[model samples]
Target: MHLPSRRPLLTGTAVTALLLSLSACGGGAAADAKTGEYKLVQNGVITAATQSEQPPFAITDSAGRPTGFAVELMNEAAERLDLKVQYKTTTLQGILAGLSAGQYDIGVAGVGATAERKKSVAFTTPFYWGFTDVLTLKDGKQDALPDFDGKRVGAVSGSVQEDFVHREMGGANLVKFKDQTALITQLLSGGVEAAVLGGASADAYVAKEPVRIAVKLASLQGSAFPMRKNGDPRLLKDIDHQIDEMIDDGTYIRLYKKYFHDPIASDLIKERPKLAEQVMNHPDLAPSRR
Candidate 1:
């Protein structure tokens, strides 16, 4: 119920030189920027925005230190691009505002890049893809959207999954909550017949108890970072190139496995291979394919 304020980690985030000097070409750092159109500033630093709380993406342990796959990926990207980077953690609602205000150069919150989001900032190719999964009581009468036509559905307010569920199951009554626990409570108390959850977050609530994946909903659309529009597209192009290279060079997979795979987090690791194939063949997602 309590929303924490920003925890500025700008001083702790490490940045490297090569990342700053690299020309924002369509591919990884310009192979030869010595004669490139732009030269990085001597004190170039990218202020990156993230959430104050969230794990596997961005989170701090008991000691209050930042650690996660995103921090590492952006740090390495900074090194490669020759730019010093600072990570600033804030609420999801604040990140975009910060991006627009120029408080941060780019925002990273495992946020999916949708046409809706594109209106605000340019998104690099998706760095990762995930999907929404619906959860209902094991003994519930529903198994899919059609089954819930007249039932009440619980979802977190402002979440993409909520939007998807509202769009996917039009007849179902939607109940909104501000947090994950609250949404689940409404579902368990029979306040709602089902709950639409984001990415691999459904498991976070049902970990200790038993639960089932009612149905695999739409692809999360995929998560991408946001940068202000305009010539930033050039920089976005370079970021896209790095992501492709990361995917091919095993860097992306390594990072994916670290955050999505492993025992501490099997939910992300246990991906539906078929879904991945479907993602590749998806025409709508082709623009930001990596």
Candidate 2:
């Protein structure tokens, strides 16, 4: 969770130059008068960006195609909008910048919405809530977050947990990795005493490794798709509408079970009631349920 730098808005000369380059390559943003939707980079294709290897969230399968919770959710939204999606993988740190530069139409890499993040890109209503957790090798020297004080701790270079490490555990030596797997590997190998990760990423590692959650950090608001600020209205609306539909029709819960191998509960919504209510207004998740 590194605090993002001030990002230049996705307008003016930079956007114009990027669009011109895309048009020369046979693709560019063009608004369709009839449907009121922006033509994507590739005709009929929504250019999506994601970080590779973030487990149950976004990962490349054996076929070298993106397949995971986030990717599948993006696919579902595109399907509802009658658009095809082509995924491009990059380091986690690059996803938002790419979107801001107009290099991607949408980004779905389990991005959590934060005030810092909102400056770089527009976030859709959150589709899933995530918790931040600390991980260490089972029976290792570290048993709690405090154990890492003034010691090395690993975090995905640009993730929210990395920001947590910096702000809350300022005395700890921060070691940043390009991906969560690498961060976990460092912790397992004793390169670091503990690592901070999203709860799901920690779960994925603990399933096969000798690791245990040291503690759960404060939960995040939720994960959402990141788009260029002031991007296509129809595209944003379609994605948001699809998310609302998923919650009402139970597709969101099904996807949660499929990826988490467990059930989705209203507890997630309860954890951040006001934020969730404002962003995700599905009737199925009423305040009474919380």
Candidate 3:
């Protein structure tokens, strides 16, 4: 999943300028007095930002409409709240920077809700859990993380996988790309000997490309939607409530099955214990026994 950057995507003058521009475009607003709800950037609408190519989480379809697991969940929540969503596609960095600038009300693209990220943005309750995977050419001999040490390894710039490369494979020649599409492109063309991706995303690519997972790292924190820090208490609460309602009604599980075939992540049921019974009842959703 996309993790927070150790460095700010926008700082000082750039942020100030961006904020000023957003304000001029009617960016900020007061809470609604009648409903006690947070006033949206555009009344009755959610301005959401997401990366265009983070598969199974956020991706633009052939028709240019945004559609993916995260996007669908957000859409469902908005529908429940009687609100409309307007999506803008950009790099993951742009999504983070835009939220800080009040240019977007929310960001959804398989974002990991790490403590470092919470310092800048508040997150909705986690909706997905996944591992990290290392990918190499289908016939490549490298089957383990250590085998790639001292070789060129690529990851999306600012993603947790990049941090993994630095911390775990310190000897690697690390290459960073702006997005997953470019990362996979480089991996396929031999620009990098290996690439790290979110587990489900790697699976999506592997299904279609001549690549295979060389390593599967332990799961990380769950993925969630991000909003500006301390912004819109009501909206945050509402989104979380909607997510809970979805789970209770089996809507979340239905959507999970729509985009993923693997059993629901055990960590997810651990986090939301209510899902335990559902998983137990549905054989397909149950984790496989070793």
Best by TM-score: 3
The C-alpha TM-scores of every prediction are 0.66, 0.78, 0.85
Q: Give candidate 2 misplaced runs (Cα > 4 Å).
A: 1-36, 261-290
Flag regions of model 3 displaced more than 4 Å: 1-36
Instruction: Choose the strongest candidate by lDDT.
Output: 3
Best-to-worst order by TM-score is 3, 2, 1
For residue 212, give model 3's deviation from the true position in Å. Answer: 0.1
Clashes of each: 9, 4, 0
Ranking of all predicted structures according to lDDT, beginning with the best and ending with the worst:
3, 2, 1
Clashing pairs in 3: none
RMSD of 2: 12.4
Candidate 3, 207: how far from true, in Å?
Answer: 0.7
lDDT of 3 by residue, 94-113 (tens): 88888888888999789888
Which window of ten consecutive residues has the lowest lDDT sum in model 1? Answer: 9-18
